[model samples]
Target: MKLKICLGLLMLTLGGCSSLGVEPWQKQHFAREDMALNHEKLDLSLDDHIYFSKEGSSGGRAFAGGGCGCN
Candidate 1:
Protein backbone atom coordinates (compact mmCIF):
# COMPACT_ATOMS: atom_id res chain seq x y z
CA MET A 1 0.00 0.00 0.00
CA LYS A 2 0.99 3.64 -0.21
CA LEU A 3 1.53 3.81 3.57
CA LYS A 4 3.96 0.90 3.50
CA ILE A 5 5.84 2.43 0.54
CA CYS A 6 6.11 5.76 2.33
CA LEU A 7 7.40 4.11 5.49
CA GLY A 8 10.02 2.19 3.54
CA LEU A 9 11.17 5.31 1.74
CA LEU A 10 11.41 7.24 5.00
CA MET A 11 13.46 4.46 6.56
CA LEU A 12 15.79 4.38 3.58
CA THR A 13 16.34 8.15 3.74
CA LEU A 14 17.06 8.10 7.45
CA GLY A 15 19.43 5.16 7.09
CA GLY A 16 21.52 7.04 4.50
CA CYS A 17 22.40 9.75 7.04
CA SER A 18 24.44 7.31 9.16
CA SER A 19 27.29 7.35 6.62
CA LEU A 20 27.34 11.17 6.13
CA GLY A 21 30.24 12.18 8.38
CA VAL A 22 34.03 11.81 8.61
CA GLU A 23 35.14 8.37 9.78
CA PRO A 24 37.56 7.87 12.72
CA TRP A 25 40.54 7.35 10.42
CA GLN A 26 39.54 10.36 8.29
CA LYS A 27 39.87 12.76 11.23
CA GLN A 28 43.61 13.13 10.74
CA HIS A 29 43.17 14.24 7.15
CA PHE A 30 40.40 16.66 8.01
CA ALA A 31 42.48 18.12 10.89
CA ARG A 32 45.26 19.23 8.58
CA GLU A 33 45.92 22.96 8.17
CA ASP A 34 45.18 22.81 4.45
CA MET A 35 41.77 21.38 5.30
CA ALA A 36 40.96 24.19 7.70
CA LEU A 37 37.79 26.19 7.11
CA ASN A 38 39.87 29.36 6.94
CA HIS A 39 43.41 28.89 5.64
CA GLU A 40 44.63 32.19 7.12
CA LYS A 41 44.20 32.24 10.88
CA LEU A 42 45.13 35.91 11.30
CA ASP A 43 42.64 37.10 8.67
CA LEU A 44 39.97 34.87 10.13
CA SER A 45 40.59 36.31 13.60
CA LEU A 46 40.38 39.85 12.28
CA ASP A 47 37.10 39.05 10.55
CA ASP A 48 35.75 37.52 13.74
CA HIS A 49 36.65 40.63 15.68
CA ILE A 50 34.88 42.82 13.16
CA TYR A 51 31.79 40.59 13.27
CA PHE A 52 31.70 40.66 17.08
CA SER A 53 32.14 44.42 17.15
CA LYS A 54 29.26 44.87 14.71
CA GLU A 55 26.92 42.25 16.25
CA GLY A 56 27.78 42.94 19.90
CA SER A 57 28.35 39.24 20.54
CA SER A 58 31.54 37.21 20.96
CA GLY A 59 33.06 33.93 22.18
CA GLY A 60 34.30 31.47 19.57
CA ARG A 61 37.52 29.53 19.06
CA ALA A 62 38.72 30.46 22.58
CA PHE A 63 38.61 34.19 21.76
CA ALA A 64 37.73 36.40 24.71
CA GLY A 65 36.88 40.02 24.06
CA GLY A 66 34.03 42.48 24.42
CA GLY A 67 32.00 44.18 21.69
CA CYS A 68 33.13 47.64 22.69
CA GLY A 69 35.87 47.53 20.02
CA CYS A 70 38.45 48.32 22.68
CA ASN A 71 40.65 45.35 21.79
Candidate 2:
Protein backbone atom coordinates (compact mmCIF):
# COMPACT_ATOMS: atom_id res chain seq x y z
CA MET A 1 0.00 0.00 0.00
CA LYS A 2 1.10 3.60 0.61
CA LEU A 3 3.33 2.50 3.51
CA LYS A 4 5.30 0.08 1.33
CA ILE A 5 5.83 2.71 -1.34
CA CYS A 6 7.08 5.21 1.22
CA LEU A 7 9.43 2.65 2.79
CA GLY A 8 10.89 1.68 -0.59
CA LEU A 9 11.51 5.31 -1.53
CA LEU A 10 13.17 6.01 1.82
CA MET A 11 15.44 2.99 1.41
CA LEU A 12 16.51 4.07 -2.08
CA THR A 13 17.22 7.64 -0.87
CA LEU A 14 19.33 6.45 2.08
CA GLY A 15 21.21 3.92 -0.06
CA GLY A 16 22.24 6.62 -2.54
CA CYS A 17 23.70 8.75 0.29
CA SER A 18 26.53 6.28 1.10
CA SER A 19 29.99 7.89 1.09
CA LEU A 20 32.82 6.79 -1.25
CA GLY A 21 35.40 6.11 1.48
CA VAL A 22 37.46 9.25 2.20
CA GLU A 23 40.74 8.77 4.12
CA PRO A 24 41.32 10.27 7.58
CA TRP A 25 43.90 12.78 6.33
CA GLN A 26 41.57 13.89 3.54
CA LYS A 27 38.98 14.86 6.18
CA GLN A 28 41.43 16.77 8.36
CA HIS A 29 40.04 20.13 7.30
CA PHE A 30 36.61 19.15 8.64
CA ALA A 31 38.10 18.12 12.03
CA ARG A 32 38.95 21.36 13.85
CA GLU A 33 38.44 22.68 17.42
CA ASP A 34 36.66 25.83 16.23
CA MET A 35 34.30 23.69 14.04
CA ALA A 36 33.03 21.87 17.13
CA LEU A 37 29.42 20.96 17.89
CA ASN A 38 29.20 23.89 20.33
CA HIS A 39 31.61 26.65 19.34
CA GLU A 40 29.95 29.12 21.76
CA LYS A 41 28.62 28.32 25.24
CA LEU A 42 26.50 31.46 25.53
CA ASP A 43 24.54 30.72 22.34
CA LEU A 44 23.82 27.17 23.51
CA SER A 45 22.60 28.48 26.87
CA LEU A 46 20.19 30.88 25.21
CA ASP A 47 18.75 28.12 22.98
CA ASP A 48 18.22 25.87 26.03
CA HIS A 49 16.48 28.65 27.94
CA ILE A 50 14.10 29.29 25.04
CA TYR A 51 13.26 25.59 24.76
CA PHE A 52 12.58 25.26 28.52
CA SER A 53 10.24 28.25 28.85
CA LYS A 54 8.28 27.30 25.70
CA GLU A 55 8.06 23.50 26.25
CA GLY A 56 7.36 23.53 30.05
CA SER A 57 10.49 21.41 30.64
CA SER A 58 13.84 22.46 32.06
CA GLY A 59 17.15 20.68 32.68
CA GLY A 60 20.81 21.73 32.83
CA ARG A 61 19.53 25.14 33.82
CA ALA A 62 21.93 25.19 36.86
CA PHE A 63 18.96 25.33 39.33
CA ALA A 64 15.70 23.41 39.78
CA GLY A 65 12.36 25.11 39.39
CA GLY A 66 10.10 25.57 42.42
CA GLY A 67 6.86 23.59 42.78
CA CYS A 68 4.60 26.50 41.89
CA GLY A 69 2.35 27.74 39.04
CA CYS A 70 5.34 29.00 37.00
CA ASN A 71 6.50 26.89 34.10
The prediction achieving the highest TM-score against the true structure is 2
Off by over 4 Å in 2: 51-71
How many residue pairs collide in each prediction? 0, 0
Best by lDDT: 1
Q: List all candidate RMSDs to the true structure.
A: 8.5, 6.5
Candidate 2: tens digits of C-alpha lDDT, residues 1-71: 99999999999988876745587789785688778766786887676666666776676644444444535
Task: Write model 1 residue lDDT over 7-55, tens digit each, in one string.
Answer: 9999999899886887788799887988887788788788877777667
- lDDT per prediction? 0.78, 0.69
Task: Quote the lDDT for 15 in model 1.
Answer: 95
Give the CA lDDT, 0 to 100, for residue 19 in model 2: 48
lDDT of 2: 0.69
